[model samples]
Target: MALYGITEREKAVTVTHAGVPHPDAECHGVVAQATQNRVLVVFVSALQRVAHPPAFADTDAEVGKH
Candidate 1:
């Protein structure tokens, strides 16, 4: 993915269990298929959660603020 600066081809595979995304797998596809800005946005958003802890009591008003 663009976030990783690498190219990868999608492969078909059968899965028996629930498939989960990896923390480091920021982008789903190859870098060539993504824009630098899009990658940066996702990266920044992930970092924001780390830098700022979420409110314990989240409400509809809080969600609307963003």
Candidate 2:
């Protein structure tokens, strides 16, 4: 269960898209792999950390209800 520095504990990975949890794709006994030439690598930009460009509505005095 060990290869390419993947320990037995890391042999399994929770299903995710761009590192975002995807319960639909999760499966027991599934094995995930990482390769330099494949699309298995995922990079996620934290939503709360992302800086969205300011919009004109940001200046509006009225705040929208949640």
Candidate 3:
């Protein structure tokens, strides 16, 4: 919770199990509260964009119209 900058957890919980979020944890009990590091960890679910790989989807165009 370093102002949303410093956090890399893999279950070695510490910092008194972090804090500041417990609104009835849900997502797997909020990742089990980060093994007690409370929360602020988002393993995934945040990529509104940036998934390139369709520069033409199997290209075959050269300014045509059937």
Best-performing candidate as measured by lDDT: 1
- What lDDT tens digits, residue by residue, belong to model 1 across residues 33-61? 35557766666666645643222324354
RMSD of each candidate relative to the true structure: 11.1, 14.1, 17.9
| Lowest-sum lDDT 10-residue window in model 2 | 20-29
TM-score pick, better of 2 and 3: 3
Q: What is the lDDT of residue 21 in candidate 2?
A: 27
Of the two candidates 1 and 3, the one with more favorable TM-score, higher being better, is: 1
User: Could you tell me every candidate's TM-score relative to the true structure?
Assistant: 0.24, 0.14, 0.15
Error of 2 at 9 (Å): 43
**Candidates sorted on TM-score, descending:** 1, 3, 2
Cα lDDT tens digits, model 2, 1-66, are 334333332344322212222221221112322234233323222221243222212432243222
- Tell me how candidate 2 scores on lDDT: 0.28
- Backbone atom clashes (below 3 Å) for every candidate: 3, 0, 0
Candidate 2, residue 32: lDDT? 29
